[model samples]
Target chain A: MIQIEQISKSYNAHAALKQASFKVDRGELFGLIGPDGAGKTTLIRILMTLLLPDSGKAHIGQWDVVKDYRKIRQHVGYMPGNFSLYRDLTVEENLRFFASVFGTNIKTHYHLIKPIYEQIEPFKNRRAEKLSGGMKQKLALSCSLIHRPELLLLDEPTTGVDAVSRQEFWQMLGTMKEHGITVLVSTPYMEEADLCDRVALIQNGEILEVASPKNIVDHFSSHLYRIKGKERLGLINALRSLSLFTKVYPFGEYIHCTSDEAVEPVVISQQLGQLGMDEIVIEAALPGIEDRFIELMA
Target chain B: MDSIIIDQLTKKFGSFTAVDKVSLRIQKGEIFGLLGANGAGKTTLIKILTGLSGASSGKATVAGFDIHRHVEKVKMNIGYMSQKFSLYEDLTVRENIQLFGGIYGVSSDYIKTKTTLVLDQLGLQDSAKKLVKSLPLGWRQKLAFSVAIFHEPKIVFLDEPTSGVDPITRRQFWEMIYAAASQGITVLVTTHYMDEASYCDRIAIMNAGKMEALGSPGELKAAYQVDHIEDVFIHIVR
Candidate 1:
């Protein structure tokens, strides 16, 4: 469980966090969704008691983030945005070192890290720096779990990782939740928003919306459509020029267009046809997390 | 026009073969994407093509110059931008642009005109006198991209150009790439995001130093019987 109240932090002239407040329930997987300089890292660091917030109070369980910094440090596990593992040490040595820091041994927390550690066991003797990005992530997860902390804080864990590895990393987090560990993850990828129990969409040092991903999408007020045409850029330009469309964005293979009023698919198809576009396909679609984020941003 | 052609290109480091006899071709004005898991040899292949690393065997040609025989020519004809953006944080934005233009051996007059054009295009003219470290990450990334292609190189290699940016910024970044491709400049990009792969004209998926799959996003999806490129990637890499 985690709680924060009116937390605000500023570095010189720039305010990193402004009146930001959110809570995470026990065993809940909470996500902090934001861009690079949107204060996700600053908030995470404040909650971890590594940096002191200029104002407000935060508590992990009953311990205050400031007053109980020492206790909180032992009770929480943190994986920094940048890999902080000892590069010169072997995988097993790194794990052992983290375990020893918490006044425990690897065998003591073997059951806690078994699922993730087993994947990297064969390369236990390899130097941490030599491991692949995915492998290093797994090893970091393993080390973080070696202490059996009740709370886990992951800062953009899947930012530079591949899709399959990103999926696997999230899967590992899901398994951790099953083990009754509470997780707070920050990521720039909007697709990962759906995986969290709840997400706080932060931007420019302010929390815009905090809700479940489904709830966020449900709150999207516009009728959305997906339009595919032979000329991708031309389609975007055409759709943007239309008054019927409130927002037009190129999403993957199709251009996602939003309307203020409900519009028929046939009408859109006819309009594109009149515009000399070929192979036009228009269909009603449900909004996704990215769509909702863009709307919230606007 | 074939901007890049390769055949049986192999790059080995000591006992490990990083790139194992890979072959592919990229057309001019094409938005070619290289998709692969980390350590899948995508970086190795790009280095070999860009003349940063020597291939252990086989041959390749980039920008109408042999990679091995005419390394300088190949280097001169291509621009590279990685995730780090490779900008000098200590220098002002104008100074950074000038330094890159000088390195590419562009004339002083051309650098002056091009600098003004690039700053205007990116809307960073107001920040030209400020240090690169003072600007936001998004602005820095766009500036890095501008500097990379300032010389109007035949091919531009983008290595994860939109890694940490939000979805909105990523969309805007792709638009710039599209503009470059429209100008008949070949764009070869490597990305971990499958959603971005769909934006490319063609994509090649690499796995364990081998080309596991290569085709347009539509063709690859049809071949894999999947609706999304992520699923197609999983199907091939798994």
Candidate 2:
């Protein structure tokens, strides 16, 4: 379990955090969701003992992040967004390196990372930098989990990798959650929010919203519908041109339009039908977390 | 002007070809998204255009300068932010800005004025004096971006600059990018975020060292006849 109380941090005159507070229950895949400067990393760093908080405090289980920095590092596995393992070392070597860092041997926790580690076992002799992105990702994961820490702090672990690799990496995290590692992840992907147990949306050093992904969408203050039509760009233009819509964003094959008033589907049909747009299909749908966050920010 | 032109550009490391013979033209003032899976060669292609790495037996030009012949010119005309934060943690946030501006040959007076503008734009004017080490990751990322484009490069290469950043900040970062594009800066960014791909005027999907598809978000969707870019990728790769 993690308890954070009124944590605020500032470097020079800019405030990266402004008394932001949240807590994560044990076994929770708590997501710190925010934009570029929301202080997610600052908070993570403070909790990991990588940086000192200017004020406020956080407790990792019973250990204080500041007063007991050394102890907390033992219980947490942190995979920074860009921190790769030793590039010059082989896969086996990297695994050994990390295991030693936690005062354990790779054989001791080999079972924990076996499912992922096996994928790169053949390349065990290859240097880490020589492995594929997905392979490297797996290797990084194996290293972090080798010690079997109670808490896992991953900072944007899937930034530049391929989509499928990103998917696979998250799936691995999902499996890790079973061990109840008290996972805390920070990501800019709104789509990834659903994967978390609960997410706190942060912006400009402030918390905008915190709720389950579904709850966040349910809290959306507007009616949502997905509209598909011929000449999609023209249709988006037409819809955006409308004065009655609250938001008209292009979503995949259709444009998800939000309404201030419950506009009749038939009214849309009639209007587009008159414009020679009979191919239009409108479906009432739920708003996603990204949409809600955009709405909130707007 | 077609700001970027790559003809049969390929990059190989020993027996491994990171980027295949890829050719494409990116229009001026367009927000183009480079998308792919891990090890799909997006980063390698970016390196080639920026002249960070040499292409293997192919021609690549960025902003009308030959990548091989005019490497310095290429660097001068582009702002590049790697996937990593790439900021020296030892420097202060303001000092980092000044350092990058100096690298880009920004005049002292211009650096002062432009630094003020960028810091204000990113809402980091308050942390201008904070050491980069003490800054949060998200703030460090934004400051890194401002540093990359200090000289107002014609094209800015953002290699997942928003990675690990919060969703709200990601949106804000995109707004800043959108604003830059609106000002006629050609933006070529690489990201795995599918939603971010949707914001691009056009997108190029790469897989295993080859360009799988390239077009506007809607066009690629229509061509693949898929509902989402996620699905479109499935259709393409499958």
TM-score of each prediction: 0.95, 0.72
- Minimum summed lDDT over a 10-residue window in model 2 chain A is located at A229-238
Q: State which candidate has the highest TM-score.
A: 1
lDDT of 2 by residue, B98-153 (tens): 88889888799999998888888878878888888887676677777778767889
User: How does model 1 score on DockQ?
Assistant: 0.66
For model 2, residues A58-111, the per-residue Cα lDDT tens digits are 899999998898888888998887857999999999999999989999888777
lDDT, candidate 1, equals 0.90
Worst 10 residues of 1 chain B by lDDT: B163-172
TM-scores for chain B, in order? 0.97, 0.93
TM-score of predicted chain A against the true chain A, for each candidate: 0.97, 0.92
Q: What C-alpha lDDT do the candidate models reach, one value each? A: 0.90, 0.82
- For residue B204, model 1's alpha carbon misses the true position, in angstroms, by 0.6
Query: What total of clashing residue pairs does each candidate reach?
Result: 0, 13
